[model samples]
Target: MAKFQSLKEAVAENLRDGDTVAFEGFTHLIPHAAAHEAIRQGIKDLTLIRMTPDIIYDQMIGMGLAKKVVFSYAGNPGVGLLRRMRDAIENGWPRAIETEEHSHAAMANAYEAGAAGLPCAIFRGYRGAGLREVNPNIRSVTCPFTGEELAAVPAHRPDVAFIHAQKANRRGDVLIEGIVGVQKEAVLASKRSVVTVEEIVDDFDDLHPNLCILPHWTVTSIVEVPGGAHPSYTHGYYDRDNAAYLEWDRVSADRDLFTAWMKENVLDAGPEIFAARVKEL
Candidate 1:
């Protein structure tokens, strides 16, 4: 069994330059805060893989912490284009591998294929769509059984999968409420997996059995840190700071402002210090 003394140690020890890392979360829930800390600590040349990346990916790419990014969508909720990510792609800042998905189901379908140890997965529902034209990486394959061409997305198996859960035990048994679709696939497809939880339980039995998403045996490391998902929120703990996200979206448009923000919030602050700052916010 792998043991981690703390969240910081786990992030520092496991994350390295040039590794392909996946973050498990939706629009704004249970982000890989510890992994972001690793990025802030000068872990460079990382290839970030995700279904839909938001501010986290934008921040990393803007700060030059990532070398490449593989994802479907990236932007703020209502603020048009993601400033940093758009600028990066427009100016050819970092190596970008873009993919497109018309809906949540399509993205989930791709991850399902990845988890199932298949080279690709096909869906005939979204045929001759704009998403297919935009993403050249996704190929169209003819179905062997039906002889129909459908969109086939290649498998994505990352080097590491990082996730933040609502609760877990010392042994890394995770419990997350609601959807567990892509998270489950990402964890299964990765070579190494790390989980950070808002609260730690003494035993797996402490959590309702149905709510448990990941077992201890599947997780390589477990870290306990309350309020770990700052910009992102744990389900029942707190709500997302919409004002802060808006502020981030506005300021991050300028490169200088983005750099300054990262230095102040991420680079200069450790886990404890960062949590303290969030409390002030």
Candidate 2:
């Protein structure tokens, strides 16, 4: 069952060095505060997993928190490149991290397969793709019904997964309303999970049946962290911080500039800063 805890306590207890972790959101509800907390606690050598890795993963890579990254697409959303991730790969700034790339379809299937406790995910893909040549994890499988060939990748069962949501009830059920991704599968596939929410209420009322709501049993911890998804907007709380994204393009371009920004904005900042930053928005 889920335990209500501080982000610090939750991260410290659940995440560890060399563990495989996934911080997931589609375009919204990105778990920035939890990632920042992981960085602040100096968790290292993680095998980070995400379908679309944006700025939070970039920051994690810049901070040398990852030894490898498994993802489909990685960038700064509308912005160009994840400069820090590129530096790690090209220049070995922190360290040259290993990458296992896959297509968006394959990643989504893999998460579902993991949630089902399958050994591997078999999907029809990589027909004309070059990714199979580079990513050794992608292999070919033969179908029984026909002689058709299919793509196969190992299931993505992370050690821990993190997600941000609109709210949770007193029972610790997380409610995600907008732009749902593979977060539900990612959490179900992981050994442990953490959720940061805008608030916790007595009950989850008038919830849509189709929306994602993770039961308390599936989540390891729930942290009440309003504005935790900042830079990436929550559904109804605030708009996406396009200015912050633009500023990151500048701050992350140079090594020294990025380091300074992290020191002031992330490393030195506390959890309250997240709510404060959101309030300012």
Best by lDDT: 2
Model 1 agreement with the true structure over 155-200: per-residue lDDT tens digits: 7678888887787776666778855637878877777888877778
Alpha carbon lDDT of residue 214, candidate 1? 79
What's the TM for model 1? 0.88
> What is the alpha-carbon RMSD of candidate 1 to the true structure?
2.6
Query: Which ranges of candidate 2 are over 4 A from the true structure?
Result: none
Instruction: Name the TM-score of candidate 2.
Output: 0.98
Among all windows of 10 consecutive residues in model 2, the one with the lowest summed lDDT is 204-213
Tens digit per residue, CA lDDT, model 2, 41-141: 99999999999989999999999999999999988889899999999999998888999999999999999999999999999999989998999999999
* Number of the predicted model whose TM-score against the real structure is largest: 2
- After superposing candidate 1 on the true structure, give the runs of residues whose Cα lies further than 4 Å from its correct spot: 93-106, 277-281
* lDDT for each candidate structure: 0.72, 0.93
